[model samples]
Target: MDRARKDMIVKEILYWKDNRMLPEHYCDYLLALYTEGNRPKDKARKAKGFYFLNIILLLLIPLSLLFIYFTELSFILQMGLLIFFTITGVSLAIYFTNKGIAPQLPLAVSALILLLISVEMASHFFPHHNTALYGALMLNCLLWIAAAWKFRQHYFGISGLVGLIIIVISIFI
Candidate 1:
């Protein structure tokens, strides 16, 4: 096909896509075929390993839950696992996000949950140190804020801000 004609067809296909006039897969195929040589290579194509890691991390969620629910593990062991998973999830989130994937949201969320679990565990272990407990809470909030700043993800930043506010309120009360 002539370049001009191909460009026109590509535009028409994109119009159809925007209007949902054609099936998504068909539109995608046409777009890829027509724009293959013209478009720059997508940045996402470079991070194949990050994509694979994300998939593995997702698959582990159910298994992790099963281990927590079905096993008669001791409290210390469970806390240890939660801490390990939290660190893993947060690290993966930071790593993948720097490489250009937005799919790390779940990992970030899992890390946030693990931080909460860690806080709960700490409270149980050292019941008398209110100052230390608040400090730990602030540290978790800072981690969220740091991740949010690094990834440019507003949700994490907002949540961290809210958490900080709550901590302040708790201290005053």
Candidate 2:
């Protein structure tokens, strides 16, 4: 085919991919075939950036835990740091989900951060109240289920259900 015809076909395929009119894999295969295996440079770079950001976000989970447990920071400062982490994780999750990119990394990171902060806050504020800690856990599971429903992510739903089951088992035991 001519250069102009190939370009038009590529643009149409991209439009279908972006609009979800065609399955992503099909669009990708067509693009590759038409482009002779050379994909867009910018898209590859953008994907790499997202993957790097996701890795950084994942690393923050462990760092946050260490900061909370090992630091001499005041309660207020710890809480501030937790809040900042939660906000960043949640914002990235929402952005990835909306952009039809790989959202699971950010979603998992956000869920973990929220779980940590909720448990920490509950235990700190209600040291003698086991019920409060359990409540915090239950609430987080519910939020995970809600997020799954909203984001159409089955893994979150499965994880939420498993969490609820574990909590119930522990409560009864």
Which candidate leads in lDDT? Answer: 2
Pairs in clash, predicted candidate 1? none
List, residue by residue over 1-173, the lDDT tens digit for candidate 1: 89899889888987787567998789888888998846554356556766677776775566556546688888777667766776777777766655456745555657555665756666878888888788888888888789788767787788889999999999999
Total clashes for model 1: 0
TM-score for predicted model 1 compared with the true structure: 0.53
The per-candidate count of clashes, in order, stands at 0, 0
How would you encode candidate 2's per-residue C-alpha lDDT over 138-170 as one tens digit per residue?
999999999899988899999999999999999
Worst 10 contiguous positions by lDDT, candidate 2 = 38-47
How far off is residue 169 in model 1, in Å?
1.0
CA lDDT of each candidate? 0.73, 0.89
Report the error of model 1 at residue 152, Å.
1.2
Worst 10 residues of 1 by lDDT: 37-46
